[model samples]
Target: MNQLKLTVSILATAGLLFFIAACAQMGTLPSLPASHPEALAIGQQVNCAECHEDQQKGTLKPYKAFNHSPVFVKSHRFYAASDDRLCSTCHKSSFCNDCHTNKVQIKPSTKFGNRPDREMQHRGNFMTMHKIEGKLDPASCYRCHGRANNERCIQCHR
Candidate 1:
């Protein structure tokens, strides 16, 4: 009985040591300091609650604190314009190519599929109206199509 108890104690201690060793071998994850200096300098984080509502909230929240907001997609341009370096911290340069590919990508109508929502990009007979829209605001066209050489645009405009 005494030997059995001693064996159990040894096994428990060994198991605990192995667990600690394994945890140590797995390097810690990147963490935001209570106020990450760059984030504070950039004025993204004023307080802990900006990200961490609960103790584990910040740990689970994806990307940098402000990057996951619903408006981040629309608002990211302003932030990127101010400091692209901040954007680069999480978003790779390739991330831009997801939307802004240089090649002749599939049309959104085809890409979004042939569903009811997958009609023309604009409302009310866009194929007829797009000429007017393009002629009026070429800048808008240049967003997806490179200003220098857009074969798709040249095909129609020229």
Candidate 2:
């Protein structure tokens, strides 16, 4: 009977350690900044830079500053607008995208030694086409668009 009790206590201790490790991996719990009350009243109109003065340049400023806020982190789980739409609610998309696009360059490059011979190159565009013939799954779109109460199919299709 004593051996069974010892085994149960060991299992319980292991379970507690597992829970703490999982939470740590998920990330730190958000904290409410002292300025939260003043910032909250302004609604979405508050300029992030007004409080995050040091973040005049990179994506880290908005990400770290807002993630620390109780409001931003809580709402982030329900919607995918925290970075751009949240700020763009007051700022323009062009202002944000100009810096963002440059930061996230999407240029495709040919792999070295993998290029086709010049004489064998086709006259038209040489872009490689990948044909995925299968019944497309709609569930993938739900990762972002599925959560919002107002999201429409046209938002992505159009």
Candidate 3:
């Protein structure tokens, strides 16, 4: 009975110590802010490096990763997929949904035409260009056209 009581007391003390350590560690963990401290201009191009040359706090990636350069914009899908928590800092979920939804209501080319940096697959004169592009990369065409606008492609692709 004494041995069991000692074991129980040790376990209770160990649990209390673990709980205290966890509470102390919680304060050291990184946390994201609700919103940016500064207001960004609407529709203006964002260059994270312009303001933050160093690595952003609480994020694994450097500010350069978030820059809106042509290369970054063109390959944003990969970056966004890898760690979208960093993306939520500056952009709303809707910002990505605008361009990435399965059934695109408005072609990005039309919706964000003013922003030429964005790479829209079927931009101006796509009808004329698709024949050559399709031959080069048929998979790209099938990805979106396979389901979204099957009727249009079926008329000719079949």
Candidate 4:
């Protein structure tokens, strides 16, 4: 009976320690700030590696992951979709809205004409490319033009 009581006490103590540790971890949970501390220069390309050498604090993704290399500029959608919370820390929703939203008044290629380093859709002779691209991945076209600008597309497609 004494051995049984000791075993029960040990189990109870172990469970209590685990619960406390979990609660402590929860109390000190890591979270990102709502915005960057300082305003970044307009049109000045940032090099994150210059300032930050370590991986991101809460998440272990490398700081270089945020760099706007041509590869990153082209494939940013996948990264954004994976964790837009990380993107929001550095960029305002309006930054993405400029391209992704229906409110865009000017074409992205025209608006970012000065920023040749940044990739924009329909950059050069898209009419020729779209014929091939549309056949390869019609869903890609539908993402932008399906509901919003189908009228413009139907004018040509139909």
Candidate 5:
């Protein structure tokens, strides 16, 4: 009975810790900046720099910055895709082409190689292990090679 009680207590503690970590990761978002609402209300263009307090590294951080807010990461894709020139305001066309283009692709890995501590995609052994990974996550492959005539995919898949 005592052992079972200890086990249950340990599990309960672990569950609570997990819940706290998840809450931290799913950051609490404050209300949208006054500019967003005011811009929409008055039919004016929204300027992000107005609300963002600082620019660090490359990311434009909002006034109440918390490194990387989960809310922003989840919704940024929607904001980027809906506009034609919105991204150019903050990001170069080359930034979009890095992931979206079918041409001689420059891997994010190359850019991030200088910072070895940062989390990176397609690790050292990826080239050798990619076939199994591709089979498991075909959707990832399609992101870069969605074209029906993708020569890159054809080189291996065909």
Candidate 6:
């Protein structure tokens, strides 16, 4: 009788461990896409709430308020517009060229427009070589990385 009880207890313990492991694995899994059409469409809509749900709800909020701030508008600009051109509006070539030219290194050999390498007279755009080894630079990232962060590239690209 004692042996049977011990065996049952062992089985129960093993089952509990397996259940916990499964739960942990599930948490690590990527979230599935929205099932409903409306939900998927809503996902495309750029809003402060979309990225910063906690901040919007006033629970575990990162930023103080979402109003009357340049960051808020900046976040919306990239999300709603879905293009780098919006960024170029305020951050003119002069601003970018200052940092990119001075701090960052560029390769002049790379050709941008039509006409292959040294084929005909064409504009040669310098290529910036900033390697993203593993992690991102916190300082450089803060420009767009706001309270609510979305990893989906398609959200903005598409």
Task: Say which candidate scores most in TM-score.
Answer: 4
Clashing pairs in 6: 51-148, 52-148
- Indicate the residue-level lDDT of 36 in model 3: 72
lDDT of 3 by residue, 70-153 (tens): 788777877887868777878898787665555566667888889866566678887788889989998765544445554556
Residue range with the least summed lDDT across 10 consecutive positions in model 1:
39-48
Off by over 4 Å in 6: 37-158
Listed in order, each prediction's TM-score against the native is 0.41, 0.22, 0.62, 0.64, 0.45, 0.22
Better of 4 and 6 by lDDT: 4
lDDT of 2 by residue, 65-106 (tens): 554255753454343453454444444655333222323222
Better of 1 and 3 by TM-score: 3
Poorest stretch of ten by lDDT in candidate 6: 119-128
Ranking by lDDT: 4, 3, 1, 5, 2, 6
True-structure lDDT of candidate 1: 0.57
TM-score attained by model 6:
0.22
Q: After superposition, how far is residue 95 of candidate 2 from its true place, in Å?
A: 27
Model 3 RMSD, rounded to 1 decimal: 7.5
lDDT of 6 by residue, 50-138 (tens): 55465532132332343324465445434335433433433355543322333322222232233233222112321122234113564
Separately for all candidates shown, the number of backbone clashes (residues 3 or more apart, or on different chains) is 0, 0, 0, 0, 0, 2
Off by over 4 Å in 2: 1-13, 20-30, 39-44, 54-158
Q: Model 3: what TM-score?
A: 0.62
lDDT per residue as tens, model 5, 1-158: 99999999999999999999988976653433323333222222334445554643423334343312356443455556654343454446775565556654445667667755533457677667897898898887666545646665568766
